[model samples]
Target: MGATPEEGAAESAAALDEVAESLVSLWSLAHNAPDVPVPATQLRVLFILEHGPVNVSNLAAEMGALVSSASRLCDRLEAAGLLLRDHGRDRREVTVRLSTDGQALLDRLKVRRRDDLARVLDTMSSPARAALIWGLAQFRDAAKADKGPGSAGESFSLPA
Candidate 1:
């Protein structure tokens, strides 16, 4: 008899964690390269901004950081020409949007990351690569199904 779907998912969770760890390691190394314009946290802010403008308070919540901390992060990014802050409808409210430079930087970082992963994928057997591609698509489908509407899971996708 086959394992129940829940049991199968439970068994896969640890393996998923291992894969996530390895990918994070790769991302950290690539993100910290000397030429990369921003640190990881700032890059995260930039990525979030790339989606669209966000209110200062909401950005803080998204990052799980205090409003002051989020504002400080925005300060550095704005100083670096990576983003713009504007007063929202209420004069006291602040909103942030990624600058053109920030978008370019994010694009470069993504390309670098893809290249790094491609290098690793290049060394794998064709069959292994095929299996990985198929497995990841299935996993993505299942994950999307499990997530509620407008959840961050929607933001997670394999690069083309």
Candidate 2:
């Protein structure tokens, strides 16, 4: 007899909490390193937009934020020239995209983040780096399972 299902779930949850904390800490550190003029929330919005233009409601859902709060964040980002709101073909729907300045800022940030990560990875052994990648992939796959069907992992063929 092995551990009960409840015990397994508890262990999984604990692991997830650790991973989440680590992600948040790393993201906070990297995001704040440049001291960009935009607020963190606005930068988050821009990050989402980099994937593609999206409606306010959908973006809010993805960000796990209230629609109103997302709207306010969008307003601030737009005012800061980081985002642009365009009328959809339906006219009733509005789509948000990163503006030219926003793209430029994102590009700069991406380069800086890549440089930082490269520096860190350089200090890690190849096996250690591989293990870290594998662990993160597993974590991402487990998170997608919790999100139900058709999440990001479903689109790719993962090793068994």
Candidate 3:
């Protein structure tokens, strides 16, 4: 008999996790070959900032961290010229944005990572590469449709 739908999903999710780990390892190797300017935690902050400017509390919530810790991270990134902090629409609030240099850094890293991934993909059979692309497109569409725990409104908490 064929696997149940839930079993197939679990197997696919597990495989995707391994793929994600490999990709992360590849990115880390490529990112650090030239010495990354920011710590991993701060890099994550920059990634979140890439979406848009956010205040400390929201950023902290997204990172599952305390506001004080997030502020300290921003302080470090700001000191390194990778982040900017400005007054928010509310007089008492401060918002953080990635600086131009930070964006450039991200852009360069993306190029390098893509080049590396492309090299790996080049070694694969044509059919395998085509399958990978098709699978990834379908997975992306599924992810966009889910809007579950990872959605912005949940902010780290899963639905009951």
Model 2 regions more than 4 Å off: 1-23, 147-160
lDDT of 3 by residue, 1-160 (tens): 9999999999988999989898678766656765678767888888888888999999998899999999999999999999899996776899999999988877777787888888889999999999988987776666656667655333432111
User: Which tens-of-lDDT digit does each residue in 1-160 have in candidate 2?
Assistant: 8889999989988987887786556545656874687868888789889878999998898777999999899899899888999988888888899999999888887777667767777988999999988987886677556545655544332311
Pull out the clashing pairs in model 2. none
Worst 10 residues of 2 by lDDT: 151-160
lDDT: which is higher, 1 or 2? Answer: 1
* lDDT score at residue 160, model 2, on the 0-100 scale: 18
Among all candidates shown, the one with the greatest TM-score: 3
lDDT (0 to 1) per candidate: 0.85, 0.79, 0.82
lDDT, residue 114, model 2: 68
TM-score of each: 0.79, 0.73, 0.81
Models sorted by lDDT, best on top: 1, 3, 2
lDDT: worst 10-residue window of model 1: 151-160
Ranking by TM-score: 3, 1, 2
Against the true structure, candidate 2 has what lDDT? Answer: 0.79
For residues 34-147, what per-residue lDDT tens digits would candidate 1 score against the true structure?
988778899888888887999989999888899999999999999999999999676789999998898888888888888898988899999999998899889887766666
State model 1's lDDT. 0.85
